[model samples]
Target: MNAKIIIVLVSVVAAAGAIATFYSQAHAPLERVTEGFETGYGGWAPDADVPIDPNTGQPVDWYVARSTDVSFSGTHSLKFFIDGRQDDGTIWIERKVLLREGARRVNITFDLYSGEESFNTIAVVCAYAGFKDPEHEGELTVLGPANEVAGWKRYSLAVDIDTGNAQEAWVAAGISVRWETHMTYYLDDIIIEVT
Candidate 1:
């Protein structure tokens, strides 16, 4: 009887240990990255799409650079300017992020600053996260209108991708022109998480 009881106790302890190990592995902590654009662009690069000038056949004016005029957290933020006179254009900043080998999900959050709040939709906030870099406006997903708040507003987007064999993902945020007019906006405090 003593031998049988000892064997049963040993088996139960071993099973408990195995369960704990499995639980820990399945509930591993997520990896996070953040960029406030305080010091610099932090690997993020700007891209844009605009209509061509009929006279020159060249794209219209668009600009992206670091500015100190407005920011969400730091003294500096990324500024985007575009001539939406044609009622069409999109501008965004994108970066490639290294991910764990088996990472399956990505979450992105950021803040956008607009000059004033209005019901009129001049531009729409947009974001992207995928294996390939976004090359056109259609590749981006519109999060919401940028003029929702007068100062700064937060936006978030998440994507579930098959990263089993992938090592990196491209993430981006920006705005799309809605009304025919020139527009400028600032972006800052970007956070990304992979799990």
Candidate 2:
């Protein structure tokens, strides 16, 4: 009887441990951004240009380029430069992604730096989720007016997506600056994870 009790206890403990491990693994944070600035801007594109493109006769987006002068990690960071001259000012980098079912929340994080240490509110980190078919049914969350000076400051936001509908969902995340701020913003190591 003593031997049987020992075996039963041992089996129960082992099973419990296995279950815990599996739960942790299944719930482990997963990177949702297919590419994050680590490899040169990660396919993010500018949109809703304020001024005309001139050549194309279309509203041009903010000028974006990869930079090596400053970075959170690795050798590449995205640089956004804008003058406070445009009439309709809205400058941002956005990447769209299709999220799978069962995705509960999205955690968007990135490192930011500014050229001017002293100034009014200039930059922020933002994320958005939109439904494909309906297009308008989704959420958009923006976090932080990055106030760090002389170095890289990390900013993040966790957005809860309504996964009850089960239709395909689109996720977008990036760095944005208050238009007409007339400042240079550097962004690096942007990462988005879902659980």
Candidate 3:
């Protein structure tokens, strides 16, 4: 009887340990990456889509580069420029992140610095996270207005994807032109987490 009780207690303890391990593994993040643009683009690259210029028959002017004009945290930030004369265009910086082989969710958070706030929306903030890289503006999800605040503002996006056997996922954030005019914006302090 004593031996049987001891074996039962051992089994219960082992089960409890296994349960704890599973809980922690399920709740913990699989991967995380943060970028401030202090050193460089941090594996991020810029992409854009704009209307073709009538004369050049090519996409209108759009630019993205590291700059010191304004930053949310560090001394540098990513600058995005777009010609909104036609009132249509999208600009964003994108990067790939590693993911565990399974169904997982990605959470992205970042800061945007606007020169000023206005009721008239010049552009809207957008983000994307999925199994494939976003090739067109339509693939991005609009989060909110970019000009909501005069200075730095925080934005977040979460996406659940079936990674399956894939080991990489793409994440991006930027702005979509709204009003007809030229516009500039800054992005900084980006954080990506996979769970």
Candidate 4:
């Protein structure tokens, strides 16, 4: 092999590698975060009405508190306390943000922890709802009904955002349980990326 040919071949390979790296980084998804749950609720607002717990005979709104006992990625995590009323209630934490126009997609990911080995009760459940635009009536990707217990687990959902006719989007997470169910769920490290 000629010395010059070897040099040219090496140069070509290096150039190709550089180009590939640039392309990958350039096309990486951008953050359109609704919440990370790394700090408090990260702007998530409660959207459920407080109901009287039939068992305790006390009014309990959907409760969210910072938990230090367990976390998916940090020292703290959000704990969602589902009431024991058993009225098919869902406690939601939601954030409203404006979606960028044009064809777009959103990816939602989060970590969860369940205390029990399995959801034995009729009210046991795990559920997540991704972003939705009311104006466009866009479909959302929901991930849930998971009965994972004892350890930290990650969940994700990817859905298209019809931004052509939609400007605002709602990002939410919730726990839905049957009447007479009582449980505490953990959530953390939530992320929303757009592309």
Cα TM-score per model: 0.84, 0.73, 0.86, 0.70
Please give the CA lDDT of all the candidate structures: 0.90, 0.62, 0.93, 0.63
Best by lDDT: 3
Candidate 4 structure quality by residue, lDDT tens digits, 96-152? 655654537766677777776565543333333334422211222235553455776
Candidate 2 per-residue C-alpha lDDT over 30-146 given as tens digits, one digit per residue, 9 for 90 to 100: 446644466655667754335564567765456667888787777778886665334334455666555566777777677777665545556555556555422221234566565
Name the better of 2 and 4 by TM-score: 2
- Ranking of candidates on lDDT, top first: 3, 1, 4, 2
Q: Which 10 residues in a row give candidate 2 its minimum summed lDDT? A: 131-140
Worst 10 residues of 1 by lDDT: 24-33
Best by TM-score: 3
Question: In candidate 4, how many clashes are counted?
Answer: 3
Task: Tell me how far the alpha carbon of residue 65 in candidate 3 is from the true structure, in angstroms, after superposition.
Answer: 0.6
Position 105, candidate 3: lDDT = 93
Clash count per candidate: 0, 1, 0, 3
TM-score of 2: 0.73
Q: Which digits, one per residue and each the tens of the lDDT, describe model 3 over residues 1-195? A: 699999999999999999999999888889989999999999999998788877688888999999999888869999999988888999999999998866479999999988999999999999999878898999999999999999999999999888878989999999999998999999999999998
Worst 10 residues of 3 by lDDT: 49-58
Per-residue CA lDDT of candidate 1, range 1-195, in tens?
699999999999999999999998777736777998888898899998778866678897898899999988869999989988888989999999888877888899999999989899999999999999998999999999999999999999999988867788999999999998889999999998887
- Candidate 4 stretches with Cα past 4 Å from truth are 1-22, 34-38, 49-60, 119-142
Model 2 misplacement above 4 A? 1-6, 34-36, 49-61, 132-140, 165-168, 174-181
Which parts of model 1 have CA positions greater than 4 angstroms off? Answer: 1-30
lDDT for residue 96 in candidate 3, whole number 0-100: 95
**lDDT, candidate 1, at 186:** 94
